[model samples]
Each structure stands twice: as structure tokens, then as C-alpha cells.
Target chain A: MSAIGDGRSMPTGAGLFDLPPELAIDTDVARRVIAEFVRGQLRQAGFERAIVGLSGGIDSALVAYLVAEAIGAERLLCLMLPYRTSASSSRTDAETVVERLGCAGELVEISPMVDAYFGRPDTGLVGAAGPEGLTASAVRRGNVMARIRMTVLYDRSVTWGGLVVGTSNKTEALIGYTTIFGDAASALNPIGDLYKSQVRQVAAAIGVPETIIRKAPSADLWPGQTDETEAGFSYPELDRLLFWLVDRRRSVEELEAKGFAPGLVQWALKAIAGSEFKRQVAPIAKLGPRTAGVDYLYPRRRPGSART
Target chain B: MQPLRIALAQTAPRLGLLDENLASHHALIGQARAGGAGLVVFPELGLTGYLLQDLAAEVAMRLDDPRLLELAAATASDGPAGLSAIVSFVEESADHRLFIAVALLEDGRVRHVQRKLFLPTYGLFDERRFFAAGDLLRATPSRLGVGVGLTVCEDFWHLGVPQLLALDGAQLLVNVSSSPGRDLAALNEIGLGTATSWRMLLRTYAQLTTSFVVFVNRVGVDESISFWGGSEVIGPNGEAVFSAPLYDEGLYFVDVDLGDVRRERIALPLLRDERLELAVRELNRIVSERAGQADDSTSEPGAEPGLDVAAR
Candidate 1:
């Protein structure tokens, strides 16, 4: 493996100074700034292709479009994987986008593959249960499906010479609504910074399908499932509370004064606080002088500086 | 050789809120243009939040939508000296299947669009439940005097994408991604790690291919998954040129000389020394071994999870 550069020591300010003035206010400009940065990185890294899972959802849709603009559509590869319960409309929507973009695409049914591996009796009833049991059997089954999909994606990625692009976002991250290694896997991501409300804005601007942009958010792991249904709170309310609490680092009391429901606020607080572990890499034991998780914290190089 | 200035736009996105996301893009694009960047890249599914579950189909959009054209126009106007950008979106093909794709805009026109080839189905992802995988490997010629190999996130991990691009003489490889952050507790417990290991592997391949590699990841939480914004750039020699912080939205930029890639390839001779046929055979052997070890069981058709028992 090549020596990975620890960014902790890199100089922090040169690139920001040369940035465009409009970028400060323009969300598109902000996105462009990030895109240009990634583009340069690609040039430096010597990679040539990108691969994304087209889930026919707004998140994946938005990511797909941004990638097309950053690189070229020719270098982009889209994959549509459908399961037995997955709506046909979703696949239709995915195809529509692929055709309009003029990119190449294929379809793979995960049902056959997943069933072949984990649907066996020995795999346990957990593979076929719904969300009602304390066993969380349905969740486990869904997770299996998700991991199986990732495995296929990774395998295909190895064959295709491209990196897997993740499609997760901020709201989900805060609430820990994602599977550990399932949809959470990817080589890179572009929209993880934005909240659920913000994601809708960008999607509309880029002309994502109206249905995708307007529908209530859900993971579709089980029938009639919506994100809010499981989380017990809507995104708008959740985002407001999250911004105040997590982004502002406000105390629970401060959040209550903001007029949020006490119960909801408490829930959000607990969820966010409990999920801190999801935000970091592996914890390190203090054995060496410069343990990555402990003592190595300093800016080393400028943004454009040559590698040491 | 003039260095290529590339920007990775890490921004926030609202679930099912396309209009808001587009406005955000407008702002980000302006920033990249003002920064004198030749190209800008955004995250996979940056236009929409990633946890759409069943709503993915309802919100899928077509490429010819007027809104997309407007974005294209913006790209043409905002770029510096023939500016270009890579934008991610859900495209509706003629056959009506939804595809996760990236569109390249140059001189205000849609240059080329590539669909993702790998549809992830496990964990927090169920792309197979929603999308169609893409086929074909081709580089798009950019006005910037370089041929670029474009692919969405999952495509970059496969060797075929890079091999084909390098074989076709692409100088740069750009991948737009939406990688989720890993849970530290899970990593500690499982010890299997998150996507970083995979990213390192990608960097190694890029070095082997002797082409510049740019990876742009998104940040923030969407549903149960957290998008870890650890976007980075790797040199042809597999050295880290730049990397963004984890879980924060920012525009990361790097300047690179394509000439260096050519020189590196000449010096190392890895691509030349590659035995493609033999490698394919070895790959087959490895795959067969894994498949043989896998447990095989057929799921009963239409075996819906017992919703009654589940609701309990």
C-alpha cells in the first residue's frame, strides 16, 4: 500500500485565498469549489473512472449528475440493482436518467444473489423476519441485502477500475439511520454535507425527477416504511433541532428555548450524542509518539504544495 | 506544463428537496469559477439526499428536463476559459429505467454522461432495488487538452475501468462519490474497517495506472448513514496530493501536471509490464474460489416478511 498522507499537517489557507468572491455566497459556487478540488486530486492520483449505485433515489440522482459535470459522462458508469419488492417505477426512473445523460448502464437483480447466499434455513429466520421482533430480524435481513449489494458493487468495481460512490447524506448520518457496512460504503461522496432539506433544493435545481424530489423519504427496507415513521420525527423539524444542537453545540436547555418539543429535542440530543462514534475512524491506543488518533495534530503542507 | 486546478465541492443536501440542492450548486459553481478552477466536481447524489428508500422512483428525473439545461448553461457561463464541470443526477433513459449518472458540461453544453456500473444492494444501500447498472468504458475529450475518464463512485474500485481508460490514453480519472462515514464502535467491534481501506486500494491502482486520480466524497448524515467527506487526490505515484477533512463540507482543490503522470508511467513501466490475459485468468481463479466457499440457498419466491409478526 502507498503511504497515505495525513492531512493534519497540511497548510490550511492558500487555496481559500485564491477562491472566487461569488463562491462565498453561491451554493453552486461552493459545490464547484469542492468539485474543482476533487478534480485536481483525481489528476494527481492518476484515476480515470467513477462508479455509482443508481438507486433511483434523489440522493443517488443528485450525486450522479454532479459526477457527470465534474468529470465526463463517458467516464461515469451507472448500475441499477433491483430486488423483488423494489418498485418498477424506480427502475424506470433510473433508466430515464441514464438515457438522458447518454451514459452506459446495466441491471442486476440482487434477489437471486442474496437468496443464493443468505436465504437458506441455516442462515436463520432472521433473514425473513420483519421489523416487529426484538430480534430486529427484518433489520438484519435488510442489512444482509445491503451488504450483499456492496459486495457485488465492490467486486464489479474491481473489475471495472472505478471507485464506488456513496449516496448517504447528513440527516441520515446524524440519526444513525444507515446500515453499518451496507449503503454506508463508498470510495467518495459529494452530498453528505447537506441536510435533508438542502438535498431537495439541489435536486430540484439539477432537474431530478419530480416524484423523487417530492416523495417522503424512506429506506424502503420494509413495506410502507418512511424515515420519519421510524425516527418518529419529520426532517424539517429534525433539521432545525439538529442545526441548533449539533452544529451550534448548544446545550439541551438552549434547544428547549428554541421552542422545539422537549421530547423530540431530547430524542435528537440522545441520538446525536450517541452517534458520535460513527463520525470517526478507529480509536487508537497511545503507544507511539505520533499516534494518529492522539498526538499528531498540526498543519504540514499547503494545499498546492508538492508532496514531501 | 500548466497544473490542472480541480475543485471538489462538498455541500449540504436536503432529502427530496431538488430545488434547494440546485440553488446550492449554483452557489458552489460560482465559487469554483471565481477560484479560477478549470473543472469542478460534486458528490454522488449531491442533488438529492441518499436515503430515499422507496421514493427513489417517484423523484427520478429525465436528462432533457429544462432544469438540467439551465445548469448546463450555467456551467458554460461560469467557467474560466472554457470551464467544465461534473454534475451528478438521476437520468431517465429511453427505456425508462433510472440510472445514477454524472454529466459533463463544457462550454455550456452537455458533453458526455456516464452511468454508474455497480449497483450496491447491501448495508445502507439498496441500489439494486432501485437502479440499472451502466456498461461501456470511454473517455471524454475535454477542452482542457486532456482526455478524462469519468465514472461514478463504485466504478473506480474495479480494475477494468482504470485498465480500459489507461489503455485508451486517458490522462486523468475523476470519480464523484457519496461514501458514508463508518461507525467507530462498529469498526472497533468488527475490526473490518470502513471505506478508507477501499480508497487506499484505489489509490494504489491509480498509481499503477500512472494516471492522476481524484475522489470527491460528500459529507453529512442522511437517514441512518453518515456521508464521510474525506475527498482526496492521489498522484500517479500513489502519493496523496490533497485530502479534505472527514464529515465536513468544503471545496477541496489541487493542482497537478499531467506531464508528471506520463513521466511516472515511463519511469515505472507498470502499465507496459501488465499481463492482461494472465491477470484475467488469475481473477477468475480467485472469484471461483470465493464463490465456491459462499453458502448457496434459494429464497422462496414472494416470501414477504411476516408484517404481522414484524409489527409486534
Candidate 2:
């Protein structure tokens, strides 16, 4: 039976209350459910081909596998982008993912190109002025690399008539671990809603490589840098706190009741509240009577129109 | 021919609160259904909320996310005369990119999804930072016999997407938007008719294309940004059929006859007289000139304008 039919057949009237008696935490079932939904969306959007940037990381690996399962390997293109700071093993991990997924892929080394532009003594050292100079420098450098990669992706998208797919998960997105207009760009994303922990569950169900799945999440922007280390909190703790505060809409006191550290809850709330600007359209002055994001409002579509 | 009843949901979304926003949508959908609305439309990015900058990538969901599925099931169960609505959200792509997306749900399943094709990079609209622009511009086939062209906020402002959809035989044009209020004071100071200019643009498109136009916008405040919700419906003659209140979240319903669109187009005959071949030739000439200009001004190599085809 088709996945849509499978979804439709699953009793809906029960709402969230009617959990099956033996509701096992089946990540595979969830993956299939998510994949089916994404696939249906692509079909609805009239897109058959999908292009993805394959970083040697769990998030990208999981997204690639899901896309393969959803739309098939034949319709997916995995672009492996390795930068100067990238580990040799990163390439191998990416290759293994493409092989396992049986998808077509191309390796693009961004070192020579990145070095030529930013490695120059004059331009490269602008952001690298202090003791923690390299961190800032690497960020600027990473932005260039990310934009370059997107340029390539868009070029390929035009050539192949495919949509560029995104791989960012919920955890990284919460703390602004992504570069604006760089790694954060795509025509659609499938894993953005899943937290890091949730992504691992989905990855394991899809048989993603353990090397990627188990490794500490990092942007691979600079040497010896890890995401959790940079964020100052691990994904498990962060995800748990975020789920409660953002998803559950619980207050600081409610979080304390749930046994979360007061400081941690405060920290999470502050961080989320602080980063609120990153979540919206650019602010505009009210010039007209009806402006988008300002005074214009509508639901998506109304019901019962002419159907062909 | 029966008049097509339409409702617009013009409201701002609370960031990252999926369940709460979904609940709000459900209530609106229920109201639209009960009011005998054949179709309802919401503002852009209504699901996750607009101004979700990077959060769009994080909270973006697949069309089948349980929340969406729940919505679909509700629509299906509420059926055959039940309300169908177009809901917008950020959708994650296979490569981990996000798209400003709109999905049409009828009988509890998504009928079609259209991604925003134009990513405005200037001013405060840094859509290029998050969403990858869409390529296809064809009208999606809806259950309602007529082809419906779905364009998000920015896409309708451009001629390319709307024109392409019209050429492809879209009988109705629906633009879902999350446009934030900007520089109204500047317009007043400068004595510029920005609001009237905007109305003229919408009216011209409706009249020229000889298609019914439905523009839905979001309202409410997110941080310092306030959305001006001016949801409106225009007939084939470029007349305002129905308009919702500004700066508020409310439902505005209108009835339209598809036959009028055909009759208007027949009367106008602009669509029939469009100079497709000459337009392509002019575009090529402009591109060639731009390429020559780029080579001449090689010092400013970064000034190359992105190639954009005007669809409408």
C-alpha cells in the first residue's frame, strides 16, 4: 500500500489520546512517516530531483538517507564539500554515506579556492586580530566557503532542474549555529524540526554510519571546534530544556518543578529570547496601509474551489 | 456558476509555538468551514510564525509532520462540503535548506505546495539568508477544476512568477504573504503614495492577467516588527471584491465566479495579444548588453546582476 494510504488508514479520530497499547519507540516508523510526508510534498510541488550538500556530519548524512528513501537515490544528488580545516576522515564518512545510500555524488574541495581568496595576508588577517582572532577569522572564512558552496548548489539546481534541499536540524537552528545566507539556505528542509537527539534516533533507524552518528556535532569551520563545546552545553541537556521551554511553553518555575537546574532554564530562556530576531522577515517601516509581515493576514487557502 | 466563497486568515504567528499556532489555525479553519467557505487562505509562514530567522531552518517540518497530518485528517473528516485552506510554513528540503512554502489541504491531505520563488535580499527581507528560491512557475491543479497559481509574498511583486502561471492557464492567483510594516512615516514625510501604488500594482495584475487575485497578509507584532494585515480579494476587472481590516487577525470572505475571469479575458484580449517572441528577443538583448557592461566595468566585478525573467 502507498505511504499516503498507510497514513490515511491509521485512525485519526483518536487524536493524541489514542496511543496503541504497545507503542514502541519505533524510529523507523517515524522516519517512514516523515519521509512519506516530504515525498508527498515534493510531488505536490512538482519537483522530482533534489540537490543536497553532504557534509561529513550526522545531520547531512541522515537527511541524505531520508531523501534517498523518500524520492529514491536516482533523484538525489549529494555534493560533498571539504574545506581546508576539514579532516580527511570527513570525506571518507561522506563517501560511505553516499555508497550506503546508493546515491550519486561528487567531491568538491573548497580549500584551494578558499585559500586563494581569504588566505591572503592582507585580506585574511582583518578578522584575525586578537588572541581569539582565529575564531573570528575562521567564521568569516567559513561564510565565504558556505556562500561558494551555495553558488555551486544553485548552479547545479538550475542545470538539473532540481530543488536544493537543506540539512540543518532543530538544535543547531535554536542557537544560530548556522551562517545566514550560507549554510542556512535551501528550497526545502526535512530535518529542521528534529532536535539533535531526535535526529540520532532517525539516523539509527535509517542505518546511518556510526562514525557520523556518534561523533560530536560540529560545523567543521575551524580545527578542534565542536558544536556543544561552542554552545557551552551538550545536546541532550539543551534539547531537553528547549523542549520544555519552547515546545511545552513552561515557565522557569515549571521547569524547576520538572527537575531542571534553575540556571540552565534561565540560560535557555535567555538564549531563545535573545535569538528571536533571527527567526523573522527583515523589519520594514509601515509605508503602506497593507504590508506583509505588518498588517496583511490570511490563512493558507480556503476550501471548496474549482478542481480540475 | 456558483460563487466561490473564500476566507482569509490575517494573523501574526507566535514564533516556534507550533501547537499553539496550529490550534489557532484549527479554530480559524473550523470557523471558515462552518461559515460555508469553499476555500480559506492564511498568511505566509503561518505555521511556525514569520521572523523566525534561523529558526525557520530548525523548526521547519515535512508536510507530513504529525501536526500537519492532524490538520489534514481534520479537514478530511470535516468533508465533502467542509472548508479547505491554504496554510504556509517553512519546509525543509532534502539538502537541509528551507523554503517559504504554502500547502493546500483538502479532505485532510495536502493537494499542492508552492515554494516562494523570489528571495528578496535587500533591506530587512533577507529571505536569501534562509530560503532557496523555487524554479517552476506553473499553476498547480486543484480539486476545483480551475488551475490555481500559488505565489508567496515576494513572488507576486515580481512579474515572472505571476505571468508564467497565467500563461500556464491559472484561472486564479493567490499570494500568501508575511510582509512587515515599513517606512510609512517616510512615505508620509516624502508625500509619496506608496499604499496607492501597491493597490495599483495588485489591481493592474488582476486586470491585465484577467484572473481573480487573492492576497492574504499577516498581522500582529513580532519583536519590533509589526505586520500590517491587509488581506484583499480582487476580481478579473481589477475591482476589490472583498477586503479585510488592516492590522488585525480576522476572516474576510468573498464570492467570485470563475466564468467572469474568462469573460474578462475575452473582453480585454491582452493575454491573446501578448508578444512572447518579441519579449524573449528583448530579454536576450538586455542580457547581452549587461554582459558587455560587466566586462567594461571589470573593476567592480561583484556588480553582476542576477538574471531574472519576468514571468507575468
Candidate 3:
């Protein structure tokens, strides 16, 4: 959606995707900062390796690329978590990334894990949810699949001796579009601060496959499910709105004046406010004088906190 | 006259580890000494890393502390080999209030101590919640044959700090920082917006104050923040003599002729022409008006105290 050679877009020849002028970052600087962040997180936590859930989408693909860029590809493990309903192209695209980066890649199907909870409608598989899971909505099934992926990643985190890297972007995170303790769970997130369009720019810069970058972003929960269609908006427009509303701290009047629809602006504001809890730690009752997040404050990994 | 050799110790301090950071300072000082550095500057809280919420107490040191004495002992010489160093740390007063203090070490002793005046409390900063602000500022004589003024990170952010230092006959102004990098929008030429802003401020201070500006910002990750190390040396005319690479930890030596201060000051005469009494009178009036103790001449009729606008 953007033309090349403008002050905003990526400093490359032709634009790979749309990038909001305000969201346009120096990709070189972003890579350097992210590289340091990835290394810093691993070093602070006494980790030598990192794990990333690669969905073949731009977000996960870019995260995998960044993690691999920070620590060598040899130190990175790319897990392709696919449900039974997940598209075959997702696996192929994920495999392309692994092959390109030469990092360790594995395909772990979450179908059995998901089916055991949600049950199979065609077969008489009485899942743990009794008969209720058989009639479970797609939303419930998607959530279970996401959590199942998280379980596999964490279990492998022990065996692989690597921390899981998050793949959620700012646009989706602000909209409450992520599954808590599921795909949103990570030891550290490198790309959570970037918008979706910005993720594509980074993905393109980092040599993620063009096919993956151009393809419609989807959760791959079901067939023919694209994120834009489901969310009812394009990523460029959504990313721009979030940048102005959240990062720039623009008011409702200011945003409406900037040419966004009043209804759309109201909707985005509501979504940001509604998702506030998903973005923060659960609050304690503060019965104790020095609670963990209250009066007693400490950095996550202090001197003695790092693993020996 | 030979240019003064300054070593910028752009280091990555260990979070909450005083012994380790002190060891690093000692090692870097030895390196600076060997490199013939007349003065070496370390970033703010270089002895104890930035982002120490409760660990400020555990790492705070008094001026008479033996550990500080040992670090100052390295500067014990009166000859040309005598090294003057500026190092920052958490200073605990007898009253138990901790302040972010920078000390000028000369002739094996603490020559001067300047505590940070401004503590940024908003955005990603929480300095005011933990440490107390200093109430004084002065330029002290240094072994390098120049009056040197020292300031911590936020102190230089105030326009008054640099101006007052220059007015007090400071030929060199040094600001030590643990500034975290943010605002990565590409409109900034320096990649990081914080870096760009600091660059502009340092150059402007150097040119306006007609003094050499030395900025040493720390590098490393303490918590979620990464301090971008873009330490620099600006001449009296605002030209950069040296700029250390961003985010690289190294002890860099930058040589600058202190005589440029004399030449630029004589040519510009901005500091000499400064009307200090006029500024003082106006500032006092503004303060009183804001405090509701005096009428604000700029205020409209029926305006509330501290408010300049009145309802029609």
C-alpha cells in the first residue's frame, strides 16, 4: 500500500508492504536493538538457546529470524505448531524459513492434543470435556489449540534448554486479539512492540520468504480464515490508528480530526481499554505491607536471580 | 599547549553488583592511565547499574567509604601523570537520603561532588521515587588546568545548569548519563530519537556556553531498558572532536584543546554579555506568581493563581 523512496517506508528499492509514516522505524536500528535485547534477555536469564513458535505468518517468521540473527541459527529452535485444520501451506512456509535460516525446525501437530479436549464430532471420542466439547464453538477450539501449543513449547523449553520467544505484535496485542497464557506466553517478546505492517517490513528486511510476507495473515484456526477479514480492517489502517491512539497519545477528537471515522475511532479506543488486563500482570489484593508488585519492587532478573 | 586527553569509559555496569562494577572501574582506570588520559569520565550510576528500585540502599556509598578511597587513590599524583577522574554512584547522606552523586577525584581524594539536580519521574523513568535531588551546583578547579563543571544525566537537561556552570567560569562541562533508548521513529537521523535529542543538546550547550561538552552515556540492559552508549566530545564552537559508536562498550580517548574555550568565548561573548541579575529577577517573579504569592503581570483579569488565562 506504500510507494518506495518516501521518507516513511523501508529504505529499500520497492516497498514490500504498507508502513505507517509514524510507525516507520530505521530497520537497521531496530535489528541492532532487537539483537541486543534478545541476547540480553538470554544472558540475564542464563539461557544459551531460544525457541520460537513459527506459524509461517509475518510476526512469528520475523521473530524467528530475529532470534536466529541474535544467537546463531544453531542456537535457535523453530517449532511449527499446527492444528489438524491448519493449512498445509503453513507447514511448507514454516519449513522454508527453517531451511533458509538453517536453524533446527520440528513439526508438532496439536491435532491429537486439541481433539482429546474438544473431541471429534465424526468419531465417538468422548473427550475430557464430556459431550459438551463436541459441540464446542470454533472460538473455544482455537483457544484450546493455542494453549496446547503453549504446553508443547514449555515442555520442550525444559528439554531444549531454551526460552520461548513471543510473536504477538502491538496491533493485535492492543486489540485483545491474543490468547492469554497461550500464544501470548513467552519468556520474552522481541516484536510485541512493533505493529503488524512494521513486522512485514522487518520480515522482508530479514530475508523472510516473500510468499510468507505477501500471504494474508491468519491464525490458521480454520480453513479460509484471514486475520484482516476476521478483524474487519486492514493491518495498515489498524496499525496507524494504534500508533496515533496509544503511542502518540492522541485524543478521540484529535484522531477523528485526522480523518479516521468516528465509529472506527470509538471502536479502537474501546478495544484498547478492554484489553488492558491482557497486557499487564494480575493485581494482588495488597493485604501484605510489601507485596510483590506493590511496595516491594525488583527487576525480573537481578544479581542472584539468574540461574547458575 | 598540549590538548587534554579525556577517556570516556562507556561501560556496561552489572545490575546491583557494586563489587563487580567497582572492579570494572578500576580496570578501566588502569587502561585509561596507560593510554595517558589526564581525565576519565564514567556514566551515571556506573558503580551501581541503573534501574535499581530497592537495591539503591544496598549499593549506596558515603564519601568517606574505604572503597571510594581506593578508587580515588588511583588518581594520587601531582605531576603530568596525575589522573583526574569523574565517577558517578549512589551517595547516601548521614540522614539516610540517597542521591545520585558524581565525584571529581584529584590528587588521591574527592575534590568535588555534584549530586543530580533533576530527577525525571515520568515515562520510563522512576528516579524521583527512589533518590533525592541535589540542591547545589558549582564548577571546581581540576588538575588539567581548567575549571571543570560536573553534572549527572538529568541535571544537564535543565538549560540553567549549563549556563550557570559556564557563568561560574567552567571551561569544560561533563554530563554522565544512563539514558535508556526509546522512540525509534525513522524521522530521527541518529536511528534512536533519544540519541538525536542528546546530540543536539550537547552541541547547543557547547556552542552557547563556549565550553567543551563531554557526554558519556552508559551501555547495557538493566531490566527492559537498554542504555545507548553514544559518548562524545564537543569543542567550544560545537564541533564534534570524537563520537564513540552507539551501544559499544569501550574506553575511548578524545583529545581537545582547552584553549578553544578562550578563543570562542572572546569571539562569541555570549556568556560575558549574559544579564544574570535580570534573569534572577524575572525567575523570582515567575516563581512567586506561580506560588500565588505575587500578581502575574502576564495573567488576564480574574485568572486563577498559576493560570495565565481567564474565562470571558
User: What TM-score, computed on C-alpha atoms, does each candidate reach?
Assistant: 0.47, 0.47, 0.97
- For all the predictions, what are the DockQ values? 0.02, 0.01, 0.61
Clashing pairs in 3: none
Off by over 4 Å in 2: A1-308, B77-82, B185-194, B288-312
Question: Model 2: per-residue lDDT, tens digit, A90-197?
Answer: 888999998998888987787666665554443445332443333446668777888888878888887776778888787777867777667788777777767777
What does candidate 3's lDDT look like per residue over B56-149, in tens digits?
A: 9989999999999999998888465889889999999999999999999989999999999999999989999999999999999887889899
| Model 2: native contacts recovered, as a fraction | 0.00
By TM-score, the better pick of 1 and 2 is 2
lDDT of 1 at A96: 75
Candidate 3 runs further than 4 Å off: A1-15, B304-312
Native-referenced Cα lDDT, model 1: 0.70
Per-residue CA lDDT of model 3 for A201-292, tens digit only, reads 78877888999988999999889999899978888898888888888899989998999888888888888899899899999998977999
Best by TM-score: 3
TM-score of chain B of each: 0.83, 0.87, 0.96
Off by over 4 Å in 1: A1-308, B77-80, B183-192, B276-312
Evaluated on CA atoms against the true complex, candidate 3 attains a DockQ of 0.61
DockQ of 2: 0.01
Go through the candidates in order and give the C-alpha RMSD of each one to the true structure.
25.1, 23.2, 2.0
